[model samples]
Target: MNFKFHHIGIVVNSIEQYEKQMLPNKKVREVIDKIQNSKLALYENFNESYIELIEPLNENSTSFNSLKKFGNHLNHLCYKVGPFSELENFMRDRKWIKVFGPVPAALFENQKVVFYLNRNSQLIEFIISE
Candidate 1:
């Protein structure tokens, strides 16, 4: 049940636009996750933390509504978890509802990820640790 801070997810109109303006000259890994219907970019900082920039692939994308409502803004916090099986019980105990996933994420080398919503409606993402 160990959880480690992994990254912050930000919804943006375009990952390329955000990278060019904010992460210029920084190395970034980009991928298209069809399961999530979004384009993603991961930038790892010197401190080993990461920032995940997400852009909707189309109007049907899950992120599309979020982007339209919040514009370019912080979307969620992600954590790396060691034991995937414990996630359900852990989240339920805290009154968090599963919103999306437990699906393979293209941006994470096909690793599984799950999304949850807390009582206050804040989103959280959990990626199964390697």
Candidate 2:
């Protein structure tokens, strides 16, 4: 199992607003679509992984509240991992709270990233890519 810092997910109220203000180049529209449709966006230097800008797409999304309160800023730090359950159980045994998902399946790629809301006042996630 190998691990790497895949991306930093920034929580924003509107992806449109951030893209217009931060990434106004017409050529970068594809990046925006990749995020909207794929839940991931690549940085300009494609060699690095990406900075995933996420907005609420559903009622269950917690990012909506974070966006409302923080007004678009760094939200979560993410790292890529393997064997998600091992990490999940480790966190659970340590008494950290699992807030969002351990959904067995994934929405983007073959990856399963679980969102955890901890008492230390930060949101953390673990990603396992298949």
Candidate 3:
């Protein structure tokens, strides 16, 4: 599988506040600090691996919905993986069952990613960086 532990995704209420509070500790590396759309803002921090803060822009956003339901908690765990096809087959063969994409990702230019939900409802995000 060659899966490398990537990041822990967290849903937040405000990106600006979160960035101010967390981004300046002098230990973490900020890979991306971007407001992707009205629905999302992505902040990626790398201390050893990564930590992604996803702030919601509206009630209709995934982050808002998740924070409403789960209260600004750990949303998902991502793993850097190989090509999409191989990982898709690997997960399918293991019966993990894909719950989200093999779609174009916002992480990097031309990056593709996917999500698999195991029996425990634990999410496994796979990123295929190009």
Candidate 4:
């Protein structure tokens, strides 16, 4: 499948408290302040991968629903890819069942994204930057 590692999505009940727990440094705090809402706090590790700490707007939100089931856990591993159909077919052939969309993601510059559940029940997100 045509894919590029983007970020790891983490569902958290509260973004502020979680950030403090994960990243409790002045420099990290400075970077966190730059991003409004600051839901997705960037903590660069060995690799340049990002950890998106997503908080639910309300009980009805997708993140909240996921939080209820999973409880502050790794929701998905995202990948930025192209020619959407090619990857879609690849997943289908491998029997990686589609879970959620090819929906328009306002956060990702209104790009199209989708989700699939792998054999281990680990959710994988595919985002296409068109």
Model 1 bad stretches (over 4 Å): 23-25
TM-scores, each model vs. reference: 0.92, 0.68, 0.76, 0.77
Candidate 3, position 7, lDDT: 78
Against the unseen true structure, what C-alpha lDDT does each candidate score? 0.87, 0.61, 0.67, 0.70
| Full candidate order by TM-score, most accurate first | 1, 4, 3, 2
Better of 1 and 4 by lDDT: 1
Give the higher-TM-score candidate: 1 or 2.
1
The backbone clash count of each candidate, in order, is 0, 0, 0, 0
Off by over 4 Å in 4: 24-46
Candidate 3 whole-model C-alpha lDDT, 0 to 1: 0.67
Please give the lDDT score at residue 128 for candidate 2. 66
Off by over 4 Å in 2: 23-47, 58-60, 104-107
Per-residue alpha-carbon lDDT of model 2 for 50-124, expressed as tens digits? 566676665455565666777779988767777876777777787888886654323344356677877787888
Which of candidates 1 and 2 reaches a greater lDDT? 1
RMSD of each: 1.5, 4.6, 3.8, 4.8
**Which lDDT tens digits does candidate 4 get at residues 77-129?**
99988867888788878899898788766556557888899988889988876
Candidate 2 lDDT at 27 equals: 24
The superposed Cα distance between candidate 1 and the true structure at residue 4, in angstroms, equals: 0.4
